[model samples]
Target: MRRLRIIGIGAGNPDHLTLQAVAALNTLDVVFLPDKGSEKGALRALREEICRRHVTRPDIRMVPLAVPKRAEAGNDYRGAVDDWHAALAEAYERLFRDHLAEGETGGLLVWGDPALYDSTLRIVEAVCARGLALDYDVIPGISSVQALAASHRLVLNGIGESVLVTTGRRLAQEGFPQNAGSVVAMLDGEQAFAAIDPAGLEIWWGAYLGAETEILASGPLAEVSEEIRRRRAEARAAHGWIMDTYLLRRSR
Candidate 1:
């Protein structure tokens, strides 16, 4: 039987590796890292840095998991994603089946917590569903949502009210939740907040969170939205990638 540890290294920062995460890292016999090409090489490098900073174990293997560019999600977004996920499952299955021997432990270091917007757990589940025999444990770490709130010095939920977390597409199509006191929007490539009516809305936006390249903006939505858009675009252009999250609140 093979054992796998899915550990979250948090968003972008090596220091975000919890003591528990470090212990898990030290226990792994092999680690799989996604090589996202040169443009996003910085991401892979960050993961490597986390391993170097922690993981004091001897002779641990680091395997590069070659990731394919996801097909464009045109009209059929879900279909495109399903196709891509299937492709990823195949890749993951190969890594596990070939690299992980019986009774040996393997690790998959996830960004943020495994339960968030990340797809690694889903891909791993898919691999298991394909008849792979393995038991996996998930170790949680700081999420970008937490990082966003901490950086902004704002709580995600209003007093006695719940926070609504959703993607940019849904936020655009469904509008703000009628009762949500706070809303955190992520994976928003289009800067959807700029499309919404900024009246009575406040925003706290952060990009490349938990890293030295982090940029934060907060103010009345109308006033700060353009700056976020400009900054996000410029940062993405400079770094070739950007992961951002923002909180939108119903102004009191």
Candidate 2:
């Protein structure tokens, strides 16, 4: 039987690697790195850097995998995602057969916590369902939401108030969550915060968090929304890709 370890490397920072994650890295016979194309080459580079800085073993081999792009948006978004994951499962099976030896351990360094907005676990499940013989374990690390709150120097929730984590599309469509005092939005490419009423709201936004290109903006939503949008656009243009997260709070 083969073993797979899904290690969370934290958000864009080499220091974010936990001691456990480092140990896991050292034990792996092979490490799989996903290439998300030229636009996100920096992401791939970061993973390489982490291995260089932490993996002391000389025998560990690094393997690069081309990540398949999802189909363009249509009426069936879930269906499109299903198709994409299926393709990824096939790719994983081939990689394992080619690179991994029987009874050897392999690893995938996932950004942030694997349990967050990531789909690596789901893809692995799909791979197993498709007949790959493997057992896996998850090692948790800091998430973007945690990084955002830490960078902003604020608590995620008020006294006795709850927080909700959701996507940009839902934020744009649902306005704001009525049940929670704080909302953390991820994977929002459309600047969905712009659609909401800025009055009585505060936002803590960060881009390229924990990296050299990091940017932060906060204050009353009406006062800082335009600046955030402008800065986000500028950063995206400069980097060719951006990963950002924000915390929205209702003023008490």
The candidate that wins on TM-score is 2
List ranges where model 2 is wrong by over 4 Å: 37-39
Candidate 1: tens digits of C-alpha lDDT, residues 128-245 = 9999988999999899999998999987988899999899998988887888889999988777899888898999999888889899999999899888889888998898778889
Regions more than 4 Å wrong, model 1: 37-39
Residue pairs with colliding backbones in model 1 are none
Across 8-65, the per-residue lDDT of candidate 2 in tens digits comes to 9999888889999999998899999887744367667779899989999898999989
Query: Candidate 2's C-alpha lDDT?
Result: 0.90
Reference-based TM-score of each model: 0.96, 0.97
Output the TM-score of candidate 1. 0.96
Name the lDDT value of residue 80 in candidate 2.
94
